[model samples]
Target: MTDKAHVVIVGGGLAGLLLGCVVATTCRDRLSVTLIERALPEAPEESLDTRATAISRGSKALLDHWMLWEAVSNEAKPIEDIHVSRAARFGSAMLRDAQDAREPMGWVVENVLLQQVLVARCEAEGVALLEGREVVDFCATQENPKLTLNNEEVIDADLVVIADGAQSALRESIGIGAIRHSPSQFAIAVNCETDGADCGVAYERFTSEGPLALLPIPNGSSSRARYNVIWCAHKVKQAALLKLSDDDFIGALQAEFGWRAGKILRVGRRTGWPLGKIAARELVRARCVLFGNAAHTLHPVAGQGFNLSLRDVERLATVIATEAGQDAPFSSVERLSVFTDMSRKDHEQTMGATSQLAEMLDSPSPFVDGLASLALSTLDLTGPIKRNVAEFGMGRR
Candidate 1:
């Protein structure tokens, strides 16, 4: 190995790629990064990812700092307004971009597009990309951390970052316990074509069953308006809905979402996944650390999962930049402790708020429903409350 401190990142998904890019650019002279991904990066002509993430303004700024916003701007659809309402209830609220300056509250981009952009940025920044490689085992020591790939190849690094995702085998192998909670819900995702014009509007409609979100997406050169749908429902209902025909699924969605976005014209390939929350007990151990979903997996009600993860990456990069030196670097206990201390408040707040919202909104209790309605009404009438909520969603807080 070279004299530079080597950092090995497991997983090449959004979090891993973003972390790699940020570290490679921010600490180029101090560290060398190698990203090991299990699968090869998708080709440009491959199908667009069905899943979408709401990129808050804070995350956008972070991407801009990395000089990646320009490459993804054209493909991202800005959210100018967000409408929140409950089914057959008087409580409703609308969040407008004007309330938070003229800038977009957030932008929506497919996972594939984000991955492509980050991959390109990583390549340009000289972050070594190892495709089709998996870290099956790892050992963290005071001097050098080691990762054993499936092919029996052992790679040594000064620090190891796990971004392998929610079901991280490496994290489990290292005996890092996670607090898991299942709200007995699942999320169905698909791309939707609507009859309305592209006005950069998004919707979050809460039903008796769960919360459904419709996020705006770029219509490209076509005249049709498109939105990404994330419908959270009970596991049983989700299973039944997933089996429905395309037309039937659209009808079901229209019933829950109403005609706010106009009639749902068509629905693309539908997919569903179990929804749950997982937070690792400890974020850092010796020379190893957890990032992104490996640190926490949240419900999608607030669309804050990826946004929060990006913030973690941002703070972590800052800590590494400040603590790293020729003598003391990423693997030292001092660096890990500082990182943990700095991140605790943000992590607790984001996780607590997200978990509470998911549970309260999805509860079947009539009292909770009344409280939810009252809360929305309060948010609608109170400017301070609304602004605070909006800023929180934008990852400003």
Candidate 2:
């Protein structure tokens, strides 16, 4: 039994790793942290993470504060402008960084690279990262929380954080139910080469099928521009699109996305998964708390999923640090309540905005289409609306 408050994070994904790094660095003397991940963190040089994430400006600042931003800065592509339009629609809007000062709106980086950098930083901070271990059972109380791993290892902790993802067994075992909503959508993701120059522009084009986002990425030594494509489609169309050859898929994409960003010269391998919104009914339970996908999983329409999670990490870390500074135990109900109170508004707003945008945009009714077009046109003409949208997208508000 250690004198320090022990924290056991039950997941090694980006959110879990980030929380570990934050707490370990912020309250190292007062808190002992352990991260139990089923699989070890991948080596930095391993295969690139097929997925890419939009790191909002707020998230960037948090990463910078942790001293992890510089490590991945070279690979991150800044988005100077974002163009939003609907296919064959009369309304379109473009948000520029200049409108809200000259700061870049956000950055896009490969998932694997970010995780690798964070893992390295956590280890450097003396976080105990236990790989290939999973919690088979969990027992929580006001004073102590316990976990039983598959290897029959029973570990005790003062606090437990569940970030194991949407299908989180730990969250379920703790009697926390998730409110799930499936929009009958699937997102296809892939990397592609474009003929356009690297101008730090991103596109969010909506079509009859669903929303399509083309985010810029660091081209490195290559002269040609490159982008990561996220195209959401209904299940029926998704199956057909996934079966098409590379050339046919490119043709379909070009037809729907138009030639705004130049022609799609070549496309890399494509992968996809089902799209849905999953939010845990309760974010806090006694000495246990849910983080990241365990708390809420939103549609990728606005790229708010990871950004919201990063904000959660920042707030939770602040709460823990404040308590530790005062020599208060983090697992106490009072401290945990403070953490929840601080984060509730941000979580609710993010979840509400993301889900509402997804639902409104995906509606097939003509009334909805007309309303969306009007909204886009209004946003373009209204400075306050545009600024608010930009700020929200950048995770500033």
Candidate 3:
């Protein structure tokens, strides 16, 4: 009886939550949105993820487009410059936001805070939030796709957006499989205090063992700046690193990261996970689609995962709003395929860049260090190439 198409989004992570917000805010007249989150509000304190994320300028624009930027910006710290260099190497690249002095290349935010802001936006926009639940299975029919909830509730929808994490059971229910890259690796993430003051600068320093990323995050009332550290390497090295005492870990970090952030004064508890490239073989089938880690999981070396997914969500919302005025909705198999095609170039470019960086990070060859150094130093001096790189990094292009 209703003209508005129903859109059921599975997973309340960043991707799904943002998708629900965009669709509900932009297409409220044309669509009804529902979001399913498996985790309940009473999640244990340890269950709340404190990891930080770097979002590009392009992503900020998308958030602004949906009127959610103000809330996010309040909690975000800007990245004015990104320093890329290999430890004890001759070459380095410094990329900055040259287009507008008022704008930054990117912003860093805490993951849990971002999710909270997104959930609030979804609720304000009238999105149905089904917390503490999940989609048990997908009924993928050609005309009307549907989702069966864990509570045995069946909801029919015109489109299903799967934004679950990498291990998505619903994605598998639809016969979608993910491919993991070879040569296993791991990354250790931690929060630490540095001896330097906060200048809104980020660093990517490559070393003999692997690439070290030190991203600035907000630290409360501390005299020295704080950072989120990601040290990636082979599993053997990762295990050895994780076993070190906090002081030993700080010492090890100070040795590899150098005096860039001054000294590694203090460190919080460290957490790590095995790293590998994972991507869905196909993104869309009939009335269903995949987004976020479900579609492609990239190394955080480049910090492109969430930003890339945000663009897709924004564009899809636009398409939904535009097509809602038509006699038929935009959730048809052919139309969804077209949407996937439109996003192909970005996904390919980002995934390729992240993979290559990760491979270089884990390479045992001494020559890779020199190659990476030379590439970074050379890319810095080339005006057009550097501009293009800056544009790509900021997601402005």
How high is each candidate's TM-score? 0.95, 0.93, 0.92
Task: Note the clash tally of each candidate.
Answer: 0, 0, 0
Model 1 lDDT tens row, 236-326: 8999999999889888888878898988888778878988888999888877889889888888887988888888888888877775574
lDDT per residue as tens, model 3, 1-397: 2657888888888888988988888778778888888883321153222578898989998888778789978779889899888877788888886665688889998887788888888999999999978777677864788777889998888778888888777788889888877646789998888878689989988776567898888775567888889998788999999999989999989988888788878888788887877889888887788888888888888688888889888767766666667676755667667777888888888888877776765664767666677788898898788878878878875
Off by over 4 Å in 1: 40-49
Regions more than 4 Å wrong, model 2: 40-49, 141-143, 325-328
Tens-place lDDT per residue, model 2, 41-77, is 4533322225678998999998898888999988899
Better of 1 and 2 by TM-score: 1
Model 2: which residue pairs collide?
Answer: none
